[model samples]
Target: MLPLLLVPPALSTAFALAPVRRPFAAAAAGWVVSLPALELPVHTGIGVAAVTAGALAVGPVTTADRVGTGLAALTCGGLAVVLARHRAAARVLDRAFEGFAGSGAVDTTTRTTARNRTPWPTVLLRPWPVRPRSIRARRGLVYGPDPRANRLDLYTPRDGGRPRGVLIHIHGGHFRAGGPSRESRAMLFDHALRGWASVSTTYHLSPTPEAGFPQHLVDIKRLIYWIRTEGPRHGIGADAPIVVAGSSAGAHIAMMTALTAGDPRFQPGFEEADTSLAGAIGLYGYYGRLGAETKDISDPVRHPADGAPPVAVIHGTDDMYTPVKGSRRLERHLRAGSSNPVFYAELPGAQHGFDAVQSPRYLAVVAAIARFTEPLAG
Candidate 1:
């Protein structure tokens, strides 16, 4: 009875350890032999030993039951020895490969070349619109805890009654470089001209290894939360609809934030309550299908299962970094799953970053975004 009780647990552990291999065949044969010897203790002991031996030869076994106790002990001991040997072999191979490749010398040359490359030319230009009285410029920190983190320049429309809407602008730097001051000043001017308060935020760059993956995302989310909560004090109404707009990496973060709208990790305040965004606009944004195998997609915030806000995606067909296909894929997925509106526009010969800085063709893309938000703002 005790030996019979052990068979299920032993088989379960074996299957779990060696999912692709069939270890159950040996166990079944042993069980058949044991059935005939059930009456005698000596015969039962021999039968149990046979099954244990078969299990040990096949795969990992658990010792919770008496049937495969010895087999489980031996398998665990063998695994430890095998793991130790693999670690030693890996170290030896790594050292040999490093010596042959001369990694240290190669890395130094690469670093030197990167350092000497010219930095991206950046300039900040503020164009005061004809209605200068309706726009006011002020500098403020989004996440007040971090002093070195990016500061936001807030341009509020001064119509004297209340803000019609708010547009939060995030500047793209490929997650490494670029500041909001230069990349988004033109957009801010446009927003002010349209009588909408605009915010341009600067975030930290990836100069150090620690600043690489998700730190920029955290900074952006913090900025959004601050704007949502504190905009009322600056004359922007609390209930005023907010539109998040970004280009390139900025667009990527904005899309991620929208996808993770109700997730507590991204927005704790919105977890228990409704935190649906008014709208989201992404220019040449990168979007990844869940579970799709791709090297470009990295760590992402947990997305809400409910739904995402209405999104307008614009991408140039010739964009090298975040292709138009990515935006198209997102539009298809969003439209199929929810009632929220998704708009996609593909520009023909334009490359990445064309819409941010003005070009004759890129003006049309900007006009599309303006049109999408005009109805909501009104």
Candidate 2:
């Protein structure tokens, strides 16, 4: 009974160590185990509790029972080691930001006062990321004709003060599922606290007939057009620098959006509209062309024309969905063609959807982004 009780946590630890490789099941289980694994303290507590419960429920009455309890204790201890490894993400972020110095992107010497501290209390108490009362989210703002597909949720300071900068965040689901809500709430909340208004918008998914290839990119441009023309009405100032960011597939769009600014091809009917960005950031992104059928329509590397904004690409070394090699290729491409510096943070032991939780790894990432985007806000 003791060893059996320990089986679930043990398997979760194993999966975290070596992520599930299956296509369909990996997505679901990866997120399930990834959170506690990244947020070490939470996992530690759970592991300790499991061991304690198992020991208390089944005392060492027999030789097998004693051996089972010992094995459970060892498993709990091994998980602690895994949890401790999350602290190394700070150093990873530091090395990534090292490229900013003397590159003319942002002042590398300037740093944010924000510390990369994981909210352990909140992590243990709440399963999902929390939005502070100070930040107000305005949902269901239509950015295009399709009210549901082409809508955005805007997060602004509750004080209604003019924003210093704007952040446009796109959600990722391999270009199929997912939307603006409940994604990257940690990053959104953190920036909102820094007096920046952030937009999380949705795009038409694949197989939706009306959606495919560049259609998703067009929807993002439409949202940008709406922001530039109609943002003032919503307390966003005209001078506020707008930076784009996304996770996974959304990251591909964000990079392409920055690289193809004002290009008539992507702009479509709104060709004259300025869809430029102050900068862009990609989290666990995919940079290659979607497929042979999609070609360069979804690829960020193929569209690097010039005058590219200062970009940051952060990826997990352990990401099961998107490989880190793609991000490395993007970094090299941007360095060769981009007018500004390209910051690449290759995090160790990090898995996909890292920003969904306010773990130490993600807080470090948020800090790096804050430092990178601060000078743009000025």
Q: Name the best candidate (by lDDT).
A: 2
Candidate 2 lDDT over residue span 194-263, tens digit each? 9999899899899632247788888899888888888999998766789999999899899889988998
lDDT of 1 at 82: 26
TM-score against native, each model: 0.58, 0.90
Candidate 1 error regions (>4 Å): 1-134, 207-213, 268-275, 289-306
Name the candidate that leads on TM-score: 2
Off by over 4 Å in 2: 20-35, 38-41, 50-54, 57-61, 102-127, 208-211
Native-to-model Cα distance after best TM-score fit, residue 121 in candidate 1, in Å: 26
Clashes of each: 2, 0
Local distance difference test, each candidate: 0.55, 0.78
Error at 327, model 1, angstroms = 1.6
Please give the TM-score that candidate 1 achieves against the real structure. Answer: 0.58
